[model samples]
Target: MAVTVLSVNAQQRGNRENMTPEKMAERMTEKMTEDLKLDEAQKQEVYDLNLESANKRTEMMAKEQTDKKAARENMKADQEAHEAKLKEILTNDQFVKWEEIQKEQREKMKDRRGGGGRPQ
Candidate 1:
């Protein structure tokens, strides 16, 4: 049983390690589609947006960042632009729900990291 659990965990970790931008974008777009009930056109748009964002993120992570503040600002700008596009694509109600979902996920991540309001 212990060996089986370890294998499963290792498999999951390996999947994450092997994920490419295309695969990451597809997974993200699928989740958004399920959550927001996106139409075909919206799904395609979201997938494109996700692909672009994923590629950018992969590029950023690959580079050796020298300035932490600049990196943070860049990430913030990218996030804001992404949300702006999403707002244009999603309905107001869906946008609100998406924000709520994001908030919940952030909270979960904080908890996982043993965070007590760490500064960004």
Candidate 2:
């Protein structure tokens, strides 16, 4: 039973690692649609934004193999651009809720890292 559980966990992790930008965007869109009660247009726009962000992240991950600092800076810039786009696309209330969601996720990540936050 333990072996089966471990194998399933490993397989899930592998699947996540290999997920395409479209798949990631779809998942994010679905979640955001549910959380924000988004309209069809909002869902479509969010999906596009999410796909673009995912592709940028994938590219940054590749770049990180060669230049960690440069990759980090590029990632930050990309994130800021994405956030700007999101602010433009989302309603003010939705944007505030999105920020709260992001803060919650960051807190969860910090907890997962034993409260250390990101390594500098």
Candidate 3:
């Protein structure tokens, strides 16, 4: 659910930096709906899952982390769980496509940021 819009539509948002969790979830869900051909129920499920995940991430980001490695591990674990739920919701082809999209987006982010992004 909280796929990070993977940075809130960097191209169109332009100078803007920070979007509320709800907005981020909406945008992420919209992208999934378009790319994955999600039905109404799936969209709602994805939205709720995304909103919940984003809210948790927002809170996690606000806290100070003394160990970045631990934080990254935790994030990875959560993402795995999210992906499991998503797999249950999507068809096999859709899930594969979703992973491809995520990988492509990650590559785009790395290109934009000079290789600054967490590894999966």
Candidate 4:
């Protein structure tokens, strides 16, 4: 039983680590659609945005970067660009709610990482 549980957990972790951009986009779109009550058009737009963002993130992660500081700066720039696009795509209320959701996710991630500082 213990072995089975460990194997299940490992499989789940592997799935998360190997998640594709389309899968990530679909999941994010579904969550946003449910949370924001998005229209079909809005859902489609959000999905496209999410897919693009996920692709960029995957590309960044795949890079062989010797300079951690440079990688961090690049990531920060990418995040800013993504937020700007989201602001344009979402209504004012939706944007506000999205920000709140992002904050909550960040906090949860921090807790999961044992209260580590922001990722470099």
Candidate 5:
């Protein structure tokens, strides 16, 4: 009984892993066709467009992520420089306000990290 269960589980896992990208694309196309009210010609056109869009999106997302990473590094360097300047410029009372502002900015960024907050 245990052997049978193990075999079945292994087969299921293999089936899942064996799914081709073409099959996945076909399934996605079917879903999109249903949602978009696509006729046969329209479906083909939309599928082609969607595939193109998906490729473009993938490329753009990768580049955007790279840019974001680089920008974040630059911002960190800038923030460090700015903080040093601020420390030199601000009195004790002004420094307290600066700290509060930093705290607020952190809270705002935390809310935005998951895409629920305002535009970055």
Candidate 6:
């Protein structure tokens, strides 16, 4: 059930990024009606909810992406400023753990891309 909700949340985000509002609504309606077996009223409710969530996530992701891009651009400058501090702060083990966590996150994203269906 949790996975299904998360999948819906991700789908909402993808719809926001990939399609226009009208198309997103139409697609959501179709999915709710056909795939989820929802009725007209339920579909409308779901569509509205999804659309609202999508808008919020889209804004947040856009902000995050912008922030990330800026951060990347400043990496060299920041590294020059903070490399010594970073090395003092994080030991080799911590860096290794960070890499592992990033790998796990990438795997989860890959699963989401693959429809987020039941595990095979």
Tens digits of per-residue lDDT, candidate 4, 3-61, equal 99989989999998799999999999999999988989989999999999899989998
What TM-score, to 2 decimals, does candidate 3 have?
Answer: 0.77
User: Which pairs clash in the backbone of model 3?
Assistant: 1-50
Q: Candidate 4: lDDT of 15?
A: 98
What order do you get sorting by TM-score, best first? Answer: 2, 1, 4, 3, 6, 5
Over 1-120, each residue of candidate 6 has an lDDT whose tens digit, in order, gives 999998999998776678765666577557545644555665666566556544544455456565665655555444344334323434466445644655677788878779474453
Q: What residue runs in model 4 are displaced by over 4 Å at the alpha carbon? A: 1-10, 118-120
Tens-digit lDDT string for candidate 1 (1-120): 999998998999899867999999999999999998999999999999999998888888788999988888888899999999999989899899999999999999889668765676
Query: Compared with the true structure, what per-residue lDDT tens digits does model 5 show for residues 28-104?
Result: 56864554445686556545544544454344434646577666665566557645654554455655765776687
lDDT of 3 by residue, 64-91 (tens): 9888888888788888888999898888
TM-score for each candidate, following the candidate numbering: 0.85, 0.87, 0.77, 0.85, 0.35, 0.38
Separate clash counts for every candidate: 0, 0, 1, 0, 0, 0
Which regions of candidate 6 deviate over 4 angstroms?
Answer: 1-16, 65-120
Clashing pairs for predicted structure model 4, backbone only: none
lDDT of 5 at 20: 55
RMSD of 5: 18.7
Please write out the lDDT profile of model 2 over residues 21-98, one tens digit for every residue: 889889999999998889999889999999999998877666536767777788899999999998988999999999
> What order do candidates take by lDDT, descending?
4, 1, 2, 3, 5, 6
Q: Give the Cα-based TM-score of candidate 5 against the true structure.
A: 0.35
User: Candidate 3's C-alpha lDDT?
Assistant: 0.85
Candidate 2 weakest lDDT stretch, 10 residues: 59-68
